[model samples]
Target chain A: MEFILENILNLIGFIVGLTIGILSYIGFKNTGSPTLFRLGIAFLSISVGFFVVWAGYMAEDFVLQKGHIEKWVQTLGIGIQTIGYFFIAFSHSIKSFFPKSRYLRSVGMLPLFLVSAVHIEHILRSVSFILLAYGAIETILSYFEGKKKGTIFVALGLSFLAFGEFLGWYSFVFPESILYYVSISIKIAGLISLFIPISKIPLTKIKFDSEF
Target chain B: MSKINAEARMVTTYRPHMKIIGDILSTTRDDLHSDGGASVTYLIRKANVSHTRISKILSNLVSQGLLEQVNSEGTFRYKISSNGREFLVAYQTFSRFAENFGLVI
Candidate 1:
């Protein structure tokens, strides 16, 4: 049951991410906006990341039959996702991930140093959480400035993704709990939320005054 | 806000380069004279841009084959080329898309 659920969530994530990536690419091609270009790469990276994890699950189910996924497979997937999150944050042009205050910066770095002796997967998950959280904050700041309805959805989506990654990191600590499934579900929800704003965009040709 | 205030706010808002290009192309295509062209003065008024800026933009558009310059009775005029129309369409679509993302272009 757990394996099937995991596969389903990852598949959904892959599909949603791929769709967003393609749409962003089309927008970039039309407008030559660097923001759209970055968004395209970001979603594509996220899609590929989900695909990697899903493939890993399939391989485990069919070829390995080990009843468990390899640590490296999950780590690789999360690492790729981290890259995507980085770009998402970068699209907003976040100058610094850490607060400017030296004390606050040290507090932020404390977690990574604390986990340095732990597994590589833990570190990667932490990094993913940090990136997604930063992106979410930036997006929310953008919403505050613009007050666009679409920005709200994006802000919510990024927040969900950040929270999901945070839970994913916790799932590593408690492997037997349901945190993993909840984390995956939230991430999928985040992707869908992000899609909402894009779907609302009209693809039809804009009517000009002269056309009337 | 009153309608006048709203219109004033809109006019004062910043427009990106792509948007200005779209406006120029649309004006040329739609506000043409009997000769199927618009003068620089007409474009300047409609596009709400400075004469010098519009001159540079028109030159660039002509060089890019998006606009055709014609000497109409000793007065220079510009017409939107086929490429310009296609570009305007694409620009309008993408502009709407970007606007949804809270982007200017």
Candidate 2:
């Protein structure tokens, strides 16, 4: 029962992230907004990350009796998701920050490769939470600066995502607790809130029509 | 080098022509919604494009049913059609989405 619930929740996150990613990509194509492209990459990375973790668990439980590969897979997923969130947090500055040394950007993944030790999982989770928190704060600050409609929902969504990560980190420290389910639910709600504003974007209907 | 890049970026900020058309159409819609209609000169000023570009954009928008052409006192003006208004609404929604991510559209 627990396994089923976990897979189902991850599946939901994957679908939501995929949908938002595609929509933002379309927006990027239409508007040529660099930020939209970063947003697309962020959501798609998260979607892939969730899928990797889910698939890893399934493979470990069903096929590979390997003792600890599942944890490594989860770590890798978190690492990919962190990269996505970092791009989102620094959408505007990233281009200028690494104008000359493009390869240096891959250095961010160093922590993931080194995080195989059991105790290091908690540290990785904390780092992921911090990245998410930074992104949320940036969104909230943008909202305050613009005061645009629907931005509040975006800010709210990022807050919930950060909060959910915090809870997940706490649950990891004290296993077999209610925080696990609560964190999953909060993260799901965050994805939904982030989706609320973009749900009405007219991707298919944006093309110009023939006149009367 | 940075200065040159910044100058180039400023020039190409609204590039590839399509986005400029959308911006002008949407701006024209805003003018129509608030002031009932707008002239080519008004669109040029509001859309921050050159006279030739705004003229071309207005013609394209009219052909696409996004704007209705109006002629008064031998001068051509334009009003937002229903479709144009809908486009503006959708564009606003898209802009808001992008803005939430700190992207200026």
lDDT at residue A83 of model 1 (Cα atoms): 81
Off by over 4 Å in 1: A96-110, A144-147, A204-212, B1-16, B29-38, B41-54
TM-score, per-candidate, Cα-based: 0.80, 0.65
lDDT of 2 by residue, B61-90 (tens): 899888898887788988888877766655
lDDT of 1 by residue, A6-113 (tens): 787678778877987877787777657777788888889888988999999999999999988987998898788778877887876667654799899889788778
Q: Report the number of the highest-DockQ candidate.
A: 1
- Residue-level error in angstroms, candidate 2, position A114: 14
Query: Which stretches in model 2 have alpha-carbon errors above 4 Å?
Result: A65-69, A92-120, A202-204, A208-212, B1-23, B28-44, B48-93, B100-102
Count of residue pairs whose backbone atoms collide, per candidate: 0, 0
C-alpha lDDT (0 to 100) for residue A170 of candidate 1? 93
What would the per-residue lDDT of candidate 2 be over residues A1-212, giving only the tens digit for each residue?
44766677678768878988877776666555666788889889888888887888789778996743477788887777776667666764544434266466568556666765647657766676766777777767767767865677777887888898899889977788989888878987887887787775555556533320
TM-score of chain A of each: 0.88, 0.77
